[model samples]
Target: MKASAAMRTALQRQWQEGGWLSWLLFPFSLLAAAAVAAKRLAYRAGWRRAERVGVPVVVVGNLYVGGTGKTPFIVAAAHALRERGHRPGIVSRGYGAAIGPVPRVGCGTLDPAVFGDEPALIARQAGVPVAVHPRRAEAARTLLHQHPDVDVILSDDGLQHLALARDVEIVVQDERGIGNGLLLPAGPLREPASRLRGVDAVVTNRSGGRDGTLPTPPAGVRAVDMDLVIDSVWRLADGERRPLPALPAARRIAAVAGIGNPARFFATLRRAGIRLDATVGLPDHYDYAHSPFAAIEADLILVTDKDAVKCPAPDDPRVWAVSVSAHLSDPTFFDWLETRLHGRTPA
Candidate 1:
């Protein structure tokens, strides 16, 4: 009825076959390709300016849209910088915000509606200064002025924000990698794979057969592996935390996710052995104003940390949010990052 659940699989096969599907979409892809090329050309030719702040800026972003673990990577990077004694602050474009002009985020000071969900999540998790502006350069400047002591600026999801010059660029990729390797509408790539040639590093979030290995990089581009760690679960209403209960061990549960990868969330819940009464996958960054709460009459409502931010105070005491961390396995990854941030090995 809904086309087919194998839509993505079919698209990938079609893409690999290089047939009419690819040709039919060639014009659209070409247009997207041209726009991306022009944007990069403007930056290269100095027609577009890239603003550099006083401190080093590290950008954590993805080529594909939706959750590729960029936010978690940002948190890990900020923590890493802090451990090395480099005071780190974050800046974002504040996607989905209704208000703008360089908004500042601090403890208990930002509204998700104005600063967007990810910035608020970063501010809350990093416990460091965060700022948002449509113009990332302005956001970086505002953050630096507000917290002059911050020694490093981390730009969340700014791989394509060429206007904000960055010292380090970390492109995060999920299991989908570039996703059929086509540009928007036709597939999921926001920029061509060639664009990754210039980045400082590549971090893959999850490891699956597809999109598992890092793409061929340009000379000097480093590839690394990163994993997501679900530390524990928390009550969504008031942030009361708990360990993820042993899975397949629980019954009468409902899993909710308003993130880029809803299926992943659902799969995680299923793996935990919890018999899901229902799975509610809201659009990414959903405000939760019209979430199907009526359908969630289960004993427990499990959600991701990102979704918990927007959900109303849980009407039922059983609603919980799972908070996750990104862990990089390569020792060299941190070593390289430390060198970039501090110009020396961390003590």
Candidate 2:
């Protein structure tokens, strides 16, 4: 069963207080924990060998199940590496998309129904080679063979992808951090907090705080601050460029978000002084085939960039996509990344 807002909030509070509810669900949590442990053990015991290709593989992912800015970070990382003269390709499981063979990305040819929203967004935003497969290793191999000039591979949300060997692992955490610090069905974490001990770096979208803040990184694990900043706003489908509307003028906007945290999107709009006359929060990567807001009237329709990828221009002229970029404040993270890339065997 899907969790309610009240249940989610209670779970978070229970985690903070170490309440009895956590204990009541401890039995199931234990099973989930055991499964994660066993999976890791299998990889460690050499029973499941991780495939390592010649090119460097950098994975940006989070321990939590919900969104933590992984897609934006991957887009930013691809841009960063490209600026430094590195050809980077992306691989994703294409979550929420129908399973299929390795798929290619191209203008008007990339199908969101087959490759998922984030992968399609990355392809459109980065304009770089992208391949999607349930098995990321397979996709990476295909990407490398198709575009042999690529020097590195950036895997979007692949912390748990044991089959694909990686040279650098960057763990991403948002304001929620590891919500309630509990496993699935009870909390938000996909794995235990201790699993973060081995990653190359830890990056937090928010700057600081305790609750709703990322934890301090362990020694040898670098910590960095990352922020998602909007660049510009554009009319939906028409692709007509326009300045972000002033708060007073945008007070009656209708906001729509098909992401892990729709509330976060709404809060951002509210902070921008946009009066949300209505807000529709659909499941993550929701397709726009049948929208609930067809009957609702509004002056403007605001959406995230990820959602815009599935809904191309002119089809929804009133829609505007809010583009965000991930900014890293720490230099050490880049220094380490450069070192790793330089050390890789020449491709």
Candidate 3:
């Protein structure tokens, strides 16, 4: 379910400052936590069988509901795995797609509306085979069957989806951490904070702020820091590239983001030294087929790469897409990931 602005604001407040709303919703959160715990227990107890794919699987996910930079990390990890001599494939839930059993995603393969924007973006950026289905395990199998050369599979945002067994589990966290460290309805987390204890690695994603702390992981779990790097901005109309800071400062820039966390997008622009005269925040995975740009008043428009996929080539030339890359502060995490995947240290 998409979050409304009121719901978003209330949840954000709960994350920053706990109030009566969280306490009022605390009972429902308990129900959510109980259900989540029960499902996990069923999988662990083998009450429900977790199927394993032919190839190793790595899951990059977050406990909270909003954007924790999973898509960028998946794209970066897929490329990194390829560089290490392993063919990688990605699978996603296709949150906004209207698909059947399984649809393979690639550049020009399927419309973003049919395969979801994030999946389309990953396929385009990573140049790897991607498959989307509500059942992510089935999607992984479809990707592997279609691209037999893929030695590893990366499941994007499937931490709570226990049906898909994983060899490596990476939990991503924003600077907000767990957001009151409570479950759904009361807070932002889908699962409990204890879930981090079992993840293979915990990545703290920082977009703007300096505070990089998160709940400590279990003894053996590795924690890493990541920053979203906006390398360049490209105009969607003609694919013209310009350095982010090099954009003409005279024009009024209006940033539009339909992502999980619109604030992060805005913060990225501000950090890049662009003053936003106006900002439009839409629900995560918002369909831009309606085109919000018609009403926005500004000299130029800036959008996230996620939003760029769904937007039609604008009749207006002022529209530009921000291209971001995931930069891990700790390069050792990649080495550790590679070693875990292959069961041997990289030479």
TM-score of each: 0.88, 0.88, 0.94
Model 1 residue pairs with clashes: 247-272, 247-273, 248-272, 248-273
lDDT of 1 by residue, 1-347 (tens): 12432554465556444567776887898899999999989988989889988888888888877777788889888887788777889999888786444466565446788788988888888888988887788888888888899888899987888889888888988766765677764667888888788787888776222334345666777887776667888776566777776322335778887777676677655655456777776667878887655566777778887877777857656778878887787866866887866556333
Question: Mind giving the per-residue lDDT tens digits that candidate 3 earns over 205-274?
Answer: 7885656456667887888788898999988888889998777565677989999888888988888778
C-alpha lDDT of residue 201 in model 3? 88
Per-residue lDDT of candidate 2, residues 1-347 (tens digit): 12554555565567555567777877788799999999999999999999998899998899877676788888888887887888989988888787666455442236788778888888888878888887889888888888899999999888998899999899988777776778865666788999889888888875222246556788878788786766667766667765565322543578887887676777766665567888776677778776545554876788898888776445656678887677788745565686777875321
- Model 3: runs farther than 4 Å from truth? 1-7, 103-109, 344-347
Best by TM-score: 3
Q: What's the lDDT for candidate 3?
A: 0.84
- Ranking of candidates on TM-score, top first: 3, 2, 1
- Each model's lDDT comes to 0.76, 0.76, 0.84
Question: What are the RMSD figures for all models against the true structure?
Answer: 3.4, 3.6, 2.3
lDDT of 3 at 157: 93
lDDT of 3 at 66: 74
